[model samples]
Target chain A: SQELEQSPQSLIVQEGKNLTINCTSSKTLYGLYWYKQKYGEGLIFLMMLQKGGEEKSHEKITAKLDEKKQQSSLHITASQPSHAGIYLCGADPYGQNFVFGPGTRLSVLP
Target chain B: DTAVSQTPKYLVTQMGNDKSIKCEQNLGHDTMYWYKQDSKKFLKIMFSYNNKELIINETVPNRFSPKSPDKAHLNLHINSLELGDSAVYFCASSLGPSNQPQHFGDGTRLSIL
Candidate 1:
């Protein structure tokens, strides 16, 4: 089984602060995806990185996949209260199945 | 409009009963999956179907079955549900199983009493 470890199980920060969450995989990733879930809601696709060293951003959220193909990061700039939610990183080792991270619960305070 | 939707948003039933959750996606995606988020908040893949064909099946108990009648629908049926079967079940869809990002349904919260 491909395994993924997410750091900082939970985070609290001021609204304007910048934050980053890390996802490390035990196996090479076929692709990496970032998702955000508001409390009690379903997961929302944020970004997808397929190639090594790929990077993509959506508004204030940027995601990067390292060259090693086993690590990825999600960075949020000038975070806002509306960004507060549980962020999950999912890795597809062979691009056949997806396994999600344990999820990083983030709190962006006003 | 909701792109992906699941019916029976919340379910509460006694053990040994049978239940089914329905899912539909209008995204024109070719692949769909079923996932379970346990009480500990760990999301695990249970099953995956591509174009109405069973593609991925995890080590889930045989009691849990996923049926997809077409590319747009995937339904989960749990027979003789047990107390341990309670969790938030999610349905998702993607263009491909290997590389595309998926769209998800809000989720169905199930509780087996």
Candidate 2:
């Protein structure tokens, strides 16, 4: 069975600080997606990475797929209170169904 | 209007009871899916339908049934629910099965007593 692991199961960052979260997969990723989930709400799509070494940024959040396509990282620069939420990485190993990782809870202190 | 919507934001029922959650999407997408989020925040896909036809069915138990009457609606029904059935169920839709971004609905939190 394939597995996806995320580092720093939880994080706390002061407002205006920077933070990074990593997601590693046991198999090569066909597609990698980043999503944010607010408390009591559905997940919001952040970005998608398909090719190796591909990177995307929306606002202050940036996501990068490693050259091996088995690991990805999400970086937040100048984090704010509004950026606090649960970050999840979903990977498709076979190009069909997605396998999601246990999310990393992020807290941005005001 | 919401792109994706689910009813019964919270559901609490006995272990032997049966329950249903309704989902709808207005994005005119061809694929819809049902996902379960466990207590540890691990999300897994249970079922998916494309154009009102069953496409992807995961290793879900037989007690759970998914009905897709149309391209825009997918409903989940669980029979004789057990304690393990308690979790957050999310409904999502995508333009197609592969390489498409999914839009999720606010999950229905199910609790079995």
True contacts preserved, each candidate?
A: 0.97, 0.92
Compared with the true structure, what per-residue lDDT tens digits does model 1 show for residues A1-110? 78899988999999999999999999998888899999888999999998889999999999999998999999999999999999999987774467889999999999
lDDT of each: 0.93, 0.94
Q: Residue A101: error of model 2 in Å?
A: 0.9
What docking tier does model 1 reach? high
Can you give the lDDT of residue A82 in candidate 2? 99
Q: List candidate 1 segments past 4 Å from native.
A: none
TM-score of each: 0.97, 0.97
Stretches of model 2 off by over 4 angstroms after superposition: none
